[model samples]
Target: MNKPSSCVRRALSLRPCAFAVLSLAAACAAHAEQPMQPLLLAQNARMPSLQDMVVTATRTEQPLSDLVADISIVDRETIEHSGATGVADLLARLPGVEITRNGGIGNATSMYLRGAETRFTAVYIDGVRVDSQSTGGAQWEQIPLAQIERIEVLRGPAAAVYGSDAIGGVIQLFTRKGEGAAAPYVGVGLGSQGTRKLEAGISGAIGADKALDYSLGLAHARSDGFDTKTSGAHNPDRDGYRSTSGNARLGYQINARHKLDATLLASRMNSGYDAFTYKPASPVDDRNLHRLHTAGLTWAAQWTEAYSTRVSVTDSASCYETTPSLYRTETSLRGYVWQNEYRLGAHRFSAALERREDRLDNPALTASGLAINQGRSQDALALGYGYSAGGHTVQVNLRHDDDSEFGGKGTGSVAYGYAIAPAWRVTASLGTAFRAPTLYQRFSEYGLPTLRPESGRNAELGLRYAEGRSTFSAVVYRNRVSNLIVFSAPGGCPSTFGCYASTARAQYEGLTLAASQQWAGVQWHGSIDIQNPRDLDTGKQLRRRAKHHATFGADTQVAGWTLGAEVQASGRRFENETNTQVLGGYTLVNLYASTRLARDYTLLARIDNLGDKAYELARTYATPGRTFYVGLKWAPQ
Candidate 1:
């Protein structure tokens, strides 16, 4: 008899872990024998109510409890108190999410949603889509976390509502909006490794009727970082980064029926990294320069008591350049969407027409010294229907996209949720999604013109219980992809070394268990993910992804201060797709505290990797150890 493939063995081993987590969740539910009641929160409580509205699930506002999608929300309060280094750093604490950075906060970064490739998950900032046609994903390192006010993570296929590149999930980031009285704030921070930061912002309404509101913010941060490369082959010099970012939001209410809003965010970053061209004797410092811009204009009109319409125009530009190595790429994305929503009793309907254009400019990619510029456009029409009444909820979506390169693609999804009890709910969903190949993958030196788009089919089941300060959720999902793109030996392209091809299939199957409860004056939350992401043809695990990863944390308010501690752990992972290089598993502990220093002054301190554990997110990369930051902010009461 033939031996079982490695992928099969890995999948088999993860079954026990997944079952254990499910059993735990069941046991927790059984323990809740008492009657559940509505949540009543103190003014200082941090636990978010399940009734909070979220938009990323269906591209429309829906109460969290009324939806069937697996999602997570991070508000500005959490962001300000966490003292995270970047957007990816903050999102790494969420369920079914993982991140890897080549070096520091300013270096190359990748975020995986349920073990999917970065490109499979679409990202948006203030409703503006941001992506790189050259790299096939958003530049995670370029996103400014300080300017973001809220984040929504939807962990499932939603191509029917979002168009292409929603195979894994979608992430939406929102900036601050203005309302109420004029408010202003300023902050300064000092941290280990010669880190310093300064930030300021103000928001308020100005008109007599408060019909106009605005917000503006600016931040500057610099860090003298440690050596990023541990390998002796590169230069042994300290790497550092400098960043400047700003954001503005303005809104006008044209009477009671119409409103207009505009948002803009810009950021620039310069960081140092050791390149392959480093020489021991006469090493030259390499610099990575990044500039990012996102802007959007939205108009909403209430046509009737039960109907509304919204139109938005968005544009984003991302540019990356490396000095001394002479590589530069720029991606510009423009989007236009007109969405209509209608509500009648317990039924909701939505229709949207969307258009997206992507342009890629690579001065380095030239045939005869002239720069190469390539672009593509996609036009789509989408429709959605939702019904929620009593204990049953249903949602259906369909979309058809006409691509300039790929002709036509259609996607759809259906989701249903049933309330088994006052505090318990079960959900199931099935969806189809797709992602087009990057322009660089089809036109670069190592490109293949015949490559097809990657398509995915996803199915999931979830059970959730929420009542008062206690919440528990368990989700099981499997996403299978065909025509998976990977670089292979030269044959189809001009490059003799290698070329991209759609020659493989892959599967991402995972069980995610998450829970939160307030017990003994402490608020506790945790999540664990047991997944098997493997290439179907080779039967090997995907690179840089683990089979088991988990996070646990607790927060408590004591003596007018909030204190929190967290632990992050991961199992061993393969450094390469071939599974030849093994990266060891590790654990990290982090602590944070915040308190009001005065009536108008608040202070916060955070310590990450408290034990100075040595771990690697990627091969030959050194992770930060025992980093600390302290900040003080002042705002008028």
Candidate 2:
């Protein structure tokens, strides 16, 4: 049980010299060809052109521009104009993603990528696997965003093609099958401390080319206590919480290469704050109860013109209860996934296999009540090859993963692109990743079981520029991690072990910039991200990382009315993990308006934290000062 460390045996001895230097630099870059501009044909003509099909990359179904990893797609008008209320606030407004919240808004949420480790990302809805697996994270308030329609973010390290927590990257949530017209929509909101919210949805379609589509939605929200106690006393009205979620999907297309799909999802939540008490006089309310359910089945096969296959099966269950009882927990999981693809023209290949069986019921463990009932199986294999002559585009990937609970790992990546004319372009990537060891870090009987499995290496560079109606992008990244598993201080244990494993090594670097524009009809968007995330083996400074995050927004219409403004920023951070609790930087400004009183009604208003900054993202969790909200939305056709 203690033989998987030394950084996973030097990343499994550099995986056969990194797959022979990425197969000899992808066969000497296979004749490069990079000319394709006009802003990549206007970003592929602002997509939604809808004709070319075949997706689900890796597990078969190709042609989404013939994949080379690093994917992003968010539609439904960017999820209804991104006034997000879930899906982790729409993946915290994308662009290298990062979100961590423990205060305000539905509590516990975590997601991090590029700078990895929030159990190394990997969340899926329509493809099953919705985190957890005994605390590898992702409850995100049980996920509801009124049956999301699309979201895909693939970034990097897909555990050789999606298996074992994907080692940092992969988020897919596609729901909302089809149903063009049996509609009903509703909304309600009120903000600030005593905030309130309500939502409703309905959709229908059951046969014909509609091939079955269904949707149902409901939402509820509440808030109150803004915290203050130790003696400064003010606690009791601690925000209340409630939630309900539901989803269903069905698709069948027995022809053109067979297809079948089925899905069901459910959620329930109840909340009240304050847990984690190591006897500060032991009085913590924070009642909590959460439940989740999932069911899935999928099959896609296209065994000709280049072979393809995909199979899926999923069952998920989660339960968490807290009302003292030492914070009870329950989990059940079942998964089986299979994927295969084979193409031999310009060459492409993929393979994946996953099996998960988990059962854990806890009674504050010490091994009572089925402390852990583990079952893990993952076997992944991936191969990617791409080539385009003259102008330049090169890709090479290789992956391997074998785990029955941490055993065997391999990863490799390389990417390159060039098209330095017709509006510019550039891209570069290098990768390696690994993460495993979480069943509460290897069968927690109160932690420390010689845990290990956190590894990394990454590098990136990007740039894109366009013309006419403005567009721009910039990205830079660096990540380095090693054996990172922390939580020591019980005298750094090991007198025959009680706990001790904090010799952290971390380094995260970031820079992301974005720009957008549209003239006369007015629309402008902005983005900025800068991160440092330290701790190169004790130089300290990496807790709740945030060193400048920014966002700006604008929208305009002005005749039939539609105006907006948004500003978000976060800079100061450090809420413990021995950084001694800082948390300063803050900026939040929001304002929105919509009007169109007739054609089926619409009128909305929002003001939100317009400068009432008395922050605390977690030093006893404060957050939530200024607030306001007004709303009305209805669709009547």
Candidate 3:
């Protein structure tokens, strides 16, 4: 089938949403005889206990259950079985997190972690910070899923360990690397909204003794997407998008005591968008191009039986290329960190120092109320301690950061854990965090140059039970933020275009529940979240944050087939701070299937919005409707 070039824009009312659901049903009926594959099972060997190794919560590997923070792991097996098109879709299923996108497929995207501001959360790729400096957030739409091996998410304040922008949490993406033997894979897919994708990759060891290993992947995707806005518009045109990305890695083990590694990733995208208010004479539709690149190098050495050291350097660059008269911007980050670890019996101690520079050039965007040639630098020192003994765990962290733009700030955290039984555990923690003001937030015409960093204090309590085939977890947390930066309305500002100022206090209290169970061949995974995020002064709910969020799903593997179904729901939320505009609550259903076609080959199909529900995470943002997709993958047995 050929790709679509355009779409006719029409109002996405409830009636159309209902009809779209019928269309999805018809498509599924056509494939009723095909049996899907089962859900992905654990691919790694189990440890003696549930609290296994994790790298994000602490710089060192430690048991997740033993750590004071909440963490979730998206393993390779889960990724393959989910059959997700991108990271946003996969992350939305996690507890205490919400994803909001302006449009479907390669559009501006943001994540709200525990109802915190978007800039409070940080994202890393293979330990290198990869977010855009211009926006102070990751370009989630531009991140390629083909190269990702797994994702590790640490919830709650981690500023003491990761520095700025960890007030909400930290997300780290691990790339695929060669392990044992040489292997190659390829895949192709076509889906609704005129989507098509092609991907290929290879990984293996080279030379004698398998001392050198390398992995490389390439991908290209394009979509003739639906209209981004349909409620009321002057120009009704398809907002198409195209992108290409690459990932490459190399590692060399010189000896048992020394090793070196390097990795690089690049992505480029061209996407079309429309103006806030459509107009024919002014040209409401236009396409913009973007480019992102990141590279890293590291060396590790085992100095002694109980000590190890590692040093790394990472650099990343991003560019937004648009009409010179419209807007154009570029950003770069260069960073270096040195870490040392020593272990004494069941106790571990670690220390690290980091330096990073952020630079931005917005020559063409200077007229858009933001300044040009902005730069900032930061230096941090972190120390950590961990001890484990007889069903008891203790962890503590302390860090201080000095910034050229904001002077200095200090943060720290402590947590304790106790195991009543081999499968049951209880934990509690208290932490402090801060978010440095972004360059744009300070240099823009709407900026407050004298702004101070936002600060946070949080307390968390959690319980977990993990047995043979099932696991359950529940947590309650409260985070208080002070010195919130917000735009002052014209009424309180010196001019009509109001300036930004730190004026409000905010608090977020929430409860989260998550569980996974497998009986026979059937597997179930689900989560529920309840939160009350309010502006303390006005006592009103925060914008774009739902008070209630929940997800339920089940998948099974039978024979060579796998089948899965999912449902997601969100409560009503306000569109702005004043709470006048309301976006109603909504629910969505999705279905997926995969089956082995032959040796080393498989077929996959999925339907999103099985009910063709009409809903919005943000007002006026058109989301994907009843959608269909099919693909074929090939790999060695």
Candidate 4:
């Protein structure tokens, strides 16, 4: 009899998982068997900063619970406990956020916020906007999770504050920073799908006065994934991927009123896959190379106790190369902004001016070996005001954008909130937003130069309650989108090449509810989302969007160990607007545990897809099956 296959051997290798579980349980029992001193000691110690400040909701730092907009915050503690390696995993858990991908990791990804298209959603890192000019989507896979300290999401129109690409709302990422002293850490792990990963980082304050600070992170991962296509006629070879990313930041506090900072982030990826082509095409290997980089600089000063100003600059680029086919593309963006704010009595006012340019290089293989490039630029101005007095707050903003190719457009928003009681509040908001046509959508082959900007309106009413260790929030919104771009071969256009047109409309209405509580020694959090997205032309549901979804998770510490479980479920989605192809709904359950090994070291393990259930996040794509990962981490004290 031959030896068991490699996959079989790995499956049987879960003996370590069993061992870890037993060890964790034994350690917990031993601690539980003792007095509850540790728990009491932890509770007595001043809690880790419960008052979290966020700026994404309104471009100003304010208490998370006090913001009038619908917002979600993914703190560092939550990110660490979720046992997620990919940013997509973390995003899928948020309320009203949806994702779709071509395959597994390293593949093209898409995100929909409040049922809006990916391009309409804006992404920012350290106040710098980043996106591919051609596709208008952020390179989510290239962002290393280990380098991020937190993420904030706003789920409504934000064009009045940030200009274009804010029709769906905004997401901001903050990088890690050095604390009091130097701290360094490292980690390594292995799991299913032949996956391997390594990460290391260090952060510290420098100089006698500790006025200078620096932080850096490095990460690399590789995985041999299963066939991308689960059904239909396609290649069966295993697809594999490799990725490396790095992020670094430097800061200097010149004085009590002046400060300067710089940040850089870069990433590279190589992926292999099988292509399904009927006509004559390259029979050789199919692969792609992807690279993304961003850099930013800022100088801020406080002229007086109530007046301040800032100036910033940012640059970002995204590049892609395809093998065999010899296709390559590069998109770059440069931005500059000047902002000022003044505080008077019980009101604050702000003004900003911004200029941004986009460039793309996609040369055609002409007879003469020549290349052609395309570019566009835009200028925008914004004004905002806020007032807070006696448990009541109100905010409003207005902006105007002028593009070189599309002329000019204006947008505005207003929000009001009142506290019913010390622990309860009610809020209402109305906003307008727009998405400009991408270069590919307006000037490429079969593109329409006469296309107009897609515009929309958002109206929301919300209720929130917070008391002791329990908190809950609910929001209901209605959105109307007009001048949607679509492709059709009208009259003079040839059937081989359809032309783009803008006359369509859409409506999206949704409700989101979320809650969290901590009692005794256990903590739990959950969210539910119900939405209806429809195309006004055909009165049909949007393709690849579920009408309902929910998530629940809980964790507790027993003795010297902590254990947790999570569940995520989504309703069925149609592959086409006509609703012929039905992609079934799915539910996934996961388990994770952690325990301290020594003074400065710890052990972590997780079992994903605990029951080995099969599911689909996208049509014809194969999602991960039963898998697990075990790792050890160490940090300097």
Candidate 5:
């Protein structure tokens, strides 16, 4: 999307001042060893050289730079500085990610990755799957950013280890753990459109040796609508939400080779947002309330140096209630997973077995509602061998999965990375993945019942170059889908004409380029993604798929002051499967400034939507305009 005229003028007015400040900061960084000042401990540790290890890629703890996949890590520093209020906003800033929000805040959100459907991406919290089994997708607004410690995004298929709903990729979130000392903090902020927010949290250890860790957070937010209805009156424009979430983790070491960890998490939120359907009267308070609870236990043991096994059990439940009877439902999922790994030098083999039972009870029975109980049992076996010799690393993985609902599926992948020089590297990977049909897609007898699972394959190649303070990476990928599910008019229907289920083949190709540089106390980062996702048979672009998206930002530190600015651009996309309606693109900018007030306290201020441009992310649902907020954080030892 292009920036509006007013936004362009406003940005131009600030360019001269921003350039001057950047120049001065660059000069100072030249004399200092560290360019970007430490605004948060998490941010400081996110540098490639500072991180100790990561385990999200292979289900085994390993060094971050040693993995063969393209992954992105968002630490707490990135989360706090982005001025994002929820998980959806934070994830939308990543490469190859598109988010659709229904309204300004506390609204329904859907996410798509690499041209895949909303349900293709898998979500996990502490290694436990979090998506609803019936819907096969996640509601991003249900999870708040305040409770997350870090998020790791694996940008390709991971069904080899995660089982289902991982055809596009996998996003894993780790909750906060105890740090050095107990800390309590509170924050309050006010912004545009009558927006107001308050949050408080405390995190600490419970034992003498700090073996048990716990965190509790509570947040409340409210906002007024920015649109007026046809009745010449403002719609029930009041959007208010309150959430309480807490996490506890206890780790006990039975022996040097055995360890056990248990985790408990809960979140409850009451939110309101306008519905998308047309109504006769001014619609205000057409909202939904969401409640979620999750708990799990994991045990790890190393029988020998080359053999290890992990067993985990988790349960999660969600309930959604709306003002109207058509929007109420309750879904619950309980599952257990067991995994074993055997390592021998460059060869690692794994086997896993999982069973999940899902129950969807829709009491309202609104057209598409019915009581359904489904049991999905899966078994997976994989073999991966990686060898690094003479600056060249090659890895090959073969995986097979058997699901009760969709039968047996097999996939294979090969990934290779070669260090062309001391400062440059190139990597390439080709893999096959698939997404099984959700219960609602296959067993929703109320509307349609004839549907099949979607299957696809992907290939990606990337390049990375790093020298001193500059690093650049680029990736090009192509994905082809067979038996792609689509909504179309049924043939030879017994009833009236309406939407029905069908299958269509499609192909999607995209390129993503990202670069970040630190020079003279200034760090600049930018990324651009271009995609051509279309149906093979019809040669039509996929609905809600943006053709081009870009993000640019710069972070600077001068003395003890930190300043940052970001601009995000989303291109035009279709609003419906038929491509009958299109939504124009838009560009929005955000600015943040933070300073350390004392040894244990810091203050920050953020300005969002600096141009006050009116834009609609979804059909008839407008996003917020310019907003400003200031917050203070205190940490006591």
Candidate 6:
């Protein structure tokens, strides 16, 4: 009666377009070379300056320059140099990424990629997926940055490659891997606010033929932080935090055709935050506790020179609890994937089968006499094809998921890239994505059984130029979503309170400009984002996301010491969907320096918020002032 609903109308128009795209891709592949060869990274060497290989784009390793999608890579060197206190802090420096925290490190946090909601991004450690079914997103605050070796960020919808929760994008973290002779390192740090840190790690390869490789690490950090709440209604005492984390990775090569790898990581954190109360007589010290564990095992077999197969098993558990307030929630996930790949000349094909199971448990909800222990599973089949020759690169992906609760859903994507001139390229992409309702959203007190999955349609265009040590890129994208889930007045549910509904619609559109250059004995990099993420029904911008943000930095070696400086600026933003409350714009400056202190020792120092400017990441939440940190490390040469 409501004119066939907007979602249904969009779905009806998408079918024919999807069919034509698939047909065109098939025709292109059919005309390419027929002979088969193994997909190898060493074979594609077109861009000599940019040789980094990334795996998050296609679930397979490929040269960065060859990818049609937008991606960013961060290495351990950058991580150590930035001196960031949390994973979200580090990510905010990258293009198209923004973060907000309730107070300080070890607090409730959220990240937005291209103005998408925090729950839209899919996160992984090693090959193991990490998510909170109850919260509907990765708990960014719990992930330890000390144990991470590298990170790959893909900033576009990848639902075709990853079954679900990739409506915004995907982030993959890789821990340290052993390669050379045995090496061990130790580091200690001191900082403002009584901050202290201790870390140690060892990595090496063993066995007669160096067939076995292993890495192990452990770290501990504590800080006596400042008061987080400024309203004077909550706790006025300092909120401190303590954390401990460990990681291990092992790899073995059996002959030249078979290989095995395993990874395990664990972390525990306890932090203080301001809890809400009705004009309490005295301040209350509230504690937030978190525990996380991730494990993965993978095996790869190369049957012939032209074919290979990979099998992986992964599991992860995330738990969150608050003291005094009496709330606890736990989430566990298990996954299995089998992938096969074949390459012939310039054409590559891949097929994979994946299965994922998610479980959520909440004692608080159970106390209310509710059936809160819930779970869901998804089984999917994905197919992909790629063609690269001369100056053209094309990729196509299709996936169908069978969700235990929602039945079936299909997603597809097509991308094309062409070299318009030497050192210049243009790319375009079209894709569809969806995210099912979370267990809590479906079974909580304020939930409805009839809630529908959110669906998205995305289109993007990009232009890039890379030459020698300089690179520049501009990308424009628009993503429209239907059946967006939102909570509103009671409807279709038993509860008299508000319930989750699927009547909202939204869109995320933006332009991202980024560049890197080496000139005058210094390396410079910067990025700017102009985005508009809004609700179509209300014509209001998304909360807590600025329409304009930019970052700039430069590093130079001076007299045997590496010195760097950076600037981060953001425009004003609304604190609520109605756009009535505004958070003022702010700018921050940071500086860092590192140098060899002795034969086997190095010294590093950093200063953040140089001006000690006061700002707020959230309404009524306090931000850090100027902070100082220095560290020393020792390793064998």
What lDDT score goes with residue 424 in model 3? 73
> Considering every candidate listed, which one attains the maximal lDDT?
1
**lDDT per residue (tens digit) for residues 1-637 in model 5:** 1111111011001111344334423432232333322212112223242133666667777664566677767887677665567787877777778888776555778888877777878887877667754456876777767677788877877666565677788888887665546778776666666667677777776665665556666666655545522222335555556565666666666667887777666665666565556354645455566666667788899999999999988877666666642455556667777778887786566666667666655553555345555445666666666566676777676777776766778877778888897656788888777776666555544234545667778889987655455555678998888887665664533334443365698887887766566656677666667788888988878877788876667778868989888877888888876788887788888888988888877777888878986766776666767878777766664
Backbone clash tally (model 1): 0
In candidate 5, what residue range of length 10 has the lowest lDDT sum?
Answer: 6-15
- Determine which window of 10 residues in candidate 4 has minimal summed lDDT: 6-15
Distance from true location, Cα of 170 in model 4, Å: 0.5
Clashes of each: 0, 11, 9, 0, 1, 1
Q: Arrange candidates, best lDDT first.
A: 1, 6, 3, 4, 5, 2
Candidate 3, RMSD to the unseen true structure: 7.8
Off by over 4 Å in 1: 1-48, 365-371
Query: What digit string (tens of lDDT, one per residue) describes model 1 on residues 1-637?
Result: 1111111111001223655466446534543554444321111113235677889998888887767888887877788777886899888888888888888878999999999999999999999999988888899988998899988889999999999899999999999898899899999999999999999999999886999999999999999998999886786777888888899999999989999999999888888898987878887888888888898999999999999999999998888888766778888889999999999999999999999998887775344333448999999999999999999999999999999999999999999999999878899999999999998898887888778999999999998887666667889999999999998998977788889999889999998888776668876677789899999988999999989888778788899999888888888888898999988888888998999989999999999899999889989998888999999999988
Report how far residue 244 has shifted in candidate 1, in Å: 0.6
Ranking by TM-score: 1, 6, 3, 4, 5, 2
lDDT of 4 by residue, 212-255 (tens): 99899898888887777776655666767787888888889899
Residue-level lDDT of model 2, residues 78-152, one tens digit each, is 554454566776666565666766665556777776556667777777777666655675677767765677777
Q: Is candidate 3 or candidate 6 better by TM-score?
A: 6
Tell me the tens digit of each residue's lDDT in model 6 across 162-227. 988899899999999998899899999999999999999999999978999999999999999988
Query: Against the unseen true structure, what C-alpha lDDT does each candidate score?
Result: 0.85, 0.62, 0.77, 0.74, 0.67, 0.82
Question: How well does candidate 4 match the true structure in TM-score terms?
Answer: 0.89
Model 1 lDDT on a 0 to 1 scale: 0.85
The TM-score, computed over Cα atoms with residue i paired to residue i, of candidate 5 is 0.87
- Itemize residue pairs with steric clashes in candidate 1: none
- Candidate 4 vs candidate 5: the lDDT winner is 4
